[model samples]
Target: MKKSILLMTITTITLTGFISGCSRDYTPTAEATGEDIFKGACMECHDAIEGKENIFYELTADNKNIEFFSKKISGGSLLMPKFPNITADKLKAVSQYALDHSADK
Candidate 1:
């Protein structure tokens, strides 16, 4: 009886956690700001300004600009995943914002 009760408790807790995780609102709104887009699209793989992997990429004026950022965000690289659904306006906003906050900027 105790074993059955324990199993039931574990199952309930696991299902609850899974359901809660799937209910998150990950999609950004139409009026979302640059910061919002960055958080939704980039934050999963990168920390605020740095990559989460072995190679740390600190943004700078030379390497991080509107064009570079926009291309990287839309098309992605070997390690990055492309964000095809992101609108042009959203991409521009995030790219400009990233350039403005680069280390040398």
Candidate 2:
């Protein structure tokens, strides 16, 4: 009886350890850069929008103003598409870059 109990206890511990060791350690991928995301997604519509005469002229004039443009880029208004899929941090970085590097008037 004593030997049987001891064997059962050892078997339980060994099985537990083996099962735990077999489990995978999951690690998430690093977040994508704002420029990368923009080049992949937003550039499509933006190129056309920026090509329009009056709108392009207006945006070019105020492009460097982050406060005015960041919300528009992240949330979308009028004809712009909302980047809802982007993480907040990435959206902010992309918005900042766009505002900072906007076409010079």
Candidate 3:
């Protein structure tokens, strides 16, 4: 009886943990701010959106416009992945954020 009770308790705890730890939601919601998106996606590889020391980073040629930033970010590059899920507003926001924080600025 004691062994049976112990086994049931263990099973209950294990199941509870397993069920609670699971996440079935396949899609993650987009962040509201440009800075948020930059931090979430761009920061991983680029590190600093502006003030980059790498030569390759310099040639990005923002062109002092949100359009450039939007194109580069949405289109992706050789090493970077495309951000298809980013909404138009989010795209604009992030682009502006990058431009605002650019090395020149």
Candidate 4:
């Protein structure tokens, strides 16, 4: 009787662990931030030190919209590479950050 009870307890504990692990939704370790995304990706090719003028100015001057910017980021521009892997939310955040900085001037 004690052996059966021990076996059942072990089975229950194993099942509980397995079920809990499977049910957990994985949370990404680092949430993407606009500034971090821009610095990591956009700055690679677009920094002023590289002799490329800041894109924010042109974006504002042309009255470009966030939707347009997000699409271009995901789809790539004539001079830019496609970033379709970037999440839509991250793109919007980055676009807004750029626009906000553009207006600072």
Candidate 5:
């Protein structure tokens, strides 16, 4: 009886650990591509003059550049409307794309 109880306790602990490890608190964002998000949200005002060049011309990855642009989009700027409904991950992707394509290299 003791051996059975010990085995059951060990099994319960192992199963609990496995179950907890498998659970994730964050929901995975849909795989929205950079170009897709940019075209959908940003292209209305800023023209995609040369593929990703337009976004690159105005933004960068350094100096909190991505955060700056994300805030602008979320809060609304002089000429740009507030994209309040946009998800954080999508904004991040767009900012990353601009930074990656920027000519500041």
Candidate 6:
């Protein structure tokens, strides 16, 4: 009886250790910023404009608001690529970044 009790206690401790080890701590991450999205997606094309000849400079200036920026980004123009899969929040971020950058130019 004593031997059986000892075995059961050891088993229980082993199982408890295994269970605790298996459990993972997951920390939530912060959301990506506008500049991050822009560099990931827009920088491929927009990073450089020959002779600083950016056609969208004026356009972004005109449509600096989030609503207009989101619409333009989602719908796309003749030159701009359509980003249909981009989330609305991400679009807003990139739009805000674009406007801010344009302000510097």
Best by TM-score: 1
Q: Point out the higher-scoring one by TM-score: 1 or 5.
A: 1
Model 2 segments more than 4 A misplaced: 1-29, 48-63
Model 3: worst 10 consecutive residues (lDDT sum): 19-28
Model 1 lDDT tens row, 1-87:
999999999998876664443213345579988887876766655555444332224665577668888888777664565676666
> What is the per-residue lDDT of model 5 for residues 1-105, given as tens digits with 9 covering 90 to 100?
999999999998876664443222222238767667665665544554465545345433364467766776567654445665565777777777655555542
Ranking by TM-score: 1, 3, 4, 6, 5, 2
Return the TM-score for candidate 4, rounded to 2 decimals: 0.55
Steric clash count of candidate 3: 0
> Which runs of model 1 end up more than 4 angstroms from their true locations?
1-27, 49-57
Q: Supply the TM-score for candidate 6.
A: 0.53
**The 10-residue segment with the lowest total lDDT in model 5:** 20-29
Enumerate residue pairs that collide in model 3.
none
Which residue ranges in model 3 land beyond 4 Å of their true spot? 1-31, 49-62
Query: Which residue pairs come into collision in candidate 6?
Result: none
Please identify model 4 stretches exceeding 4 Å from their true place: 1-30, 48-55, 60-62, 103-105
Could you tell me the lDDT of residue 77 within candidate 3? 54
* Candidate 6 ranges beyond 4 A from true positions: 1-30, 48-56
Provide the global lDDT of candidate 1 against the true structure.
0.66
lDDT of 6 by residue, 1-105 (tens): 999999999998876664443212211124778777666656555654455643334453456567777776677664555566556677777788777656333
Model 3 lDDT per residue over 1-105, tens place: 999999999998876665433222212246468777666666545654344542123334547678877877777654445577665787888788777766543
Q: Which candidate is the best by lDDT?
A: 1
The clash numbers for all candidates, in the given order, read 0, 0, 0, 0, 0, 0
Report, for every candidate in turn, its global Cα lDDT versus the true structure.
0.66, 0.55, 0.62, 0.60, 0.59, 0.60
| TM-score (C-alpha) between model 2 and the true structure | 0.50
